[model samples]
Target chain A: MDLQLIDQFAKNIIFEAGRRIRTAFTYDLVVETKSNANDLVTNIDRETELFLIEKIKSFDSTHKIIGEEGMGEKVDSLEGVVWIIDPIDGTMNFVKQHRHFMISIGIFVDGIGKLGYIFDVMREDLFYAIEGVGAWYNDSPLRKLQPVKIEEAVIGINASWVAPNRHIHHEKVIELVRKVRGTRSYGSAAMEIAFVVSGKLDAYVSMRLSPWDIGGGTIIAKEVGAIATNLRGEGFDFFHQDTFIIANPSIHQELLEKYIVQYD
Target chain B: MDLQLIDQFAKNIIFEAGRRIRTAFTYDLVVETKSNANDLVTNIDRETELFLIEKIKSFDSTHKIIGEEGMGEKVDSLEGVVWIIDPIDGTMNFVKQHRHFMISIGIFVDGIGKLGYIFDVMREDLFYAIEGVGAWYNDSPLRKLQPVKIEEAVIGINASWVAPNRHIHHEKVIELVRKVRGTRSYGSAAMEIAFVVSGKLDAYVSMRLSPWDIGGGTIIAKEVGAIATNLRGEGFDFFHQDTFIIANPSIHQELLEKYIVQYD
Candidate 1:
């Protein structure tokens, strides 16, 4: 497979999606609640997803797509070429702040991760990876992530994960928050993961995230020698929602063992 | 006082300081640990502060200055025309990420906030206010902030406030975190307050912050109908470090009464 070509194609599609998103922001958005009030879906999100799916289909009809807005095919397994798309990863941020949101696309072949692209629509920062070739932030190639001790690390984690919530023990997470150099919550999974890859943030932890949320970021982070896993320190499932902990290789295990507590 | 002219003058100084900061990022930095390992100060921070102080002193010799880097006069009170300066608000962010840090300058007349300026140096976005004339984000005028309920508000709060630490009760803060729509920690009080003023964030709560951190933001937020007070719902002390809660008027009292637990 021509990974470079595929990467370029993905970047073009993402940039196009970003343009559409930018245009949509100027006009009044027709927003609707999805699942819950906090889980919002704007007209722009659907439109961007449809546009991406159409581009993907025209590029390769045989490729399967799993999109956040349900505009693509429902694949049972990653058998052939699979594309995971999150039109707007931080839909709430998009609707509320009109910034900090992203369009993420992850491409896989026969269950093997290949190319990925994450575009910060407003910032116009394009983060992409071509399997083994390496990840690039805009025009420059990203360096491998450096190891960081827990005390010296700045982790990206929302307060939700550390509060008395259903997913993890709030107290243990609090301990982790205290131990780290600092904590930041941008309310966007893909962007936070991109920060980790770019060395802006040392780690990102969340109690629940969808495959589309982590798909693109996972590939980009892996290219820079970062690790992505569930709270249990296991590999992510490409078809289900799971807790995510993407961090530098040096502290990933330590964070999981010390902070992340999963109740069976 | 000519608030508008002072606003413009402050803006120019901030922009110039921003330019210096940007140029400094290109060269190797001389970083020194301050109070602790996490408390950092860079040569750039001190240099930027000195530059701003020179400009302020030259612009108006009669003006009193209070600066984070200790470059300005040590005024015992907010008398006369006072200028509170944080040359680089998010010093750690500047040292680590090279973005998100800002230059914040707050001007006052006889202890009353008269004008303010906060510039995101790397992004080149300026957020400033001219007393009665209202706040401007870049060249665009900012609208008055709309009210948001606790359940629908995105609050800017660091994880330290909710963890087992000094200042506030961790349990109550955790409850507030659970109830709010979401929480974000950007690690810069000025930027967070700017977010609150711009309606990107509904409120910002910090257990400890100095005058330089909140001075400029207070002026801007107040113009947007947001309220700035201590966690105890009292006014801020311009001469000392204190807990702060800057928020929309509608939710300010409620958040203070319910969430912010001041440990006597």
Candidate 2:
């Protein structure tokens, strides 16, 4: 498979999808509740997913697709060449803030992330990486992440993790927050993951995330010498929801061992 | 005093300051700890503050200046014309991320915020408000804020506040986080305030903030009909540090009475 050709094709469709999302702002969005009140799905999300899936199918009919909106083909395992797509990661950000949301797509060959693309819809910035190749932030090559001490690191974590919650031990998370130099939460896991690549955030932690949400970013993270794994320090299964933590190589082990002692 | 003239003058200097900051990214920054380990001040902060003070002094030296870098006047009273400045708000962000920081200035007369300016240095977006004249996001008039329910609101808050910190009760803050639709922390109080004005954030809360950190944002908040007050529901005393909360009318009382029953 020609990776550069696929990357170009992905960029074209992703940018096209972004343009549509930009225009979608003028029309009122149709929104619905998903698993819970905060987990929302919008008309744009489904439309964008359908838009991507069609473009991908047209480009290559053989590739399997796993999309968050459930409009794409499904398989129990990551067998065969597959596409994992999140039409809009941080749908809540899209519905509530109208910005900070992203379109995430990861193309894998036999369970290995080969190509990744994360487009920040509003900012007009695109981030992508190829297997065995470096990452790019738009046109420029991404800087390799430097190891940062946990005490000096500026991590991104959802406040809920540190608050009393069922997902994780709040005290240990609290201990983590205190140890870090600073903490930020942009409410978009893709953006936070991209931030790890961009050096804006030293690490990111989330209790649970799906394959679509974690796919594209992990590939980009890998290119920049960062690590993306579950709280248990396991590689993503790419077929199930799991706890997520992506950090610079230096701080990843220390964080899991010290801060994430217990979680759902 | 001619308010529009002052507004124009503020804009020119702010834009000029922003330009300098954009250039500063090319050079290595000198950083220092302030108050505590995470509390930081940088050479850019001091330089920017000094630069603004010089311009203000040249324009009108009689105006008092309360600057976070301590490069301006040392006056305890909010009497006469005064310019409150946090030359580089979110210094840690600037030093670490090289983005997400802002330059904030609030011009007041007899403690009444007459004009406010917040320049997001990297994004090059300027937000300002003239008392009774309204607010502008650069050139566009900012939309008047509408009320949002606490349960449906997205608030910007530091994670440390919801952790076991000395400033406020972490449990109450955790409850607040659970009740809200979303919580984001940008690690910059001034930018968070601008987010409130942008409607990207419905409300913003900080456990403790100095005058310079909260000044410009409160003015912009007031013009948009959002209230900026202490956690105790008291008006800010511009001369001292205090707990801060800026919320649109719809959910301010609900946040205070229900969630924040006890705080520092």
> Which number leads on DockQ?
2
TM-scores for every candidate against the unseen true structure? 0.98, 0.96
Candidate 1's residue-wise lDDT over A58-107, tens digit each?
A: 99899899999888877899989999999999988888888899998899
Model 2, position A96, has a per-residue lDDT of 75
User: Which residue pairs show collisions in model 2?
Assistant: none
Q: Chain A TM-scores, all candidates?
A: 0.98, 0.97
Off by over 4 Å in 2: none
Best by TM-score: 1
- Model 1 segments beyond 4 Å from truth? none
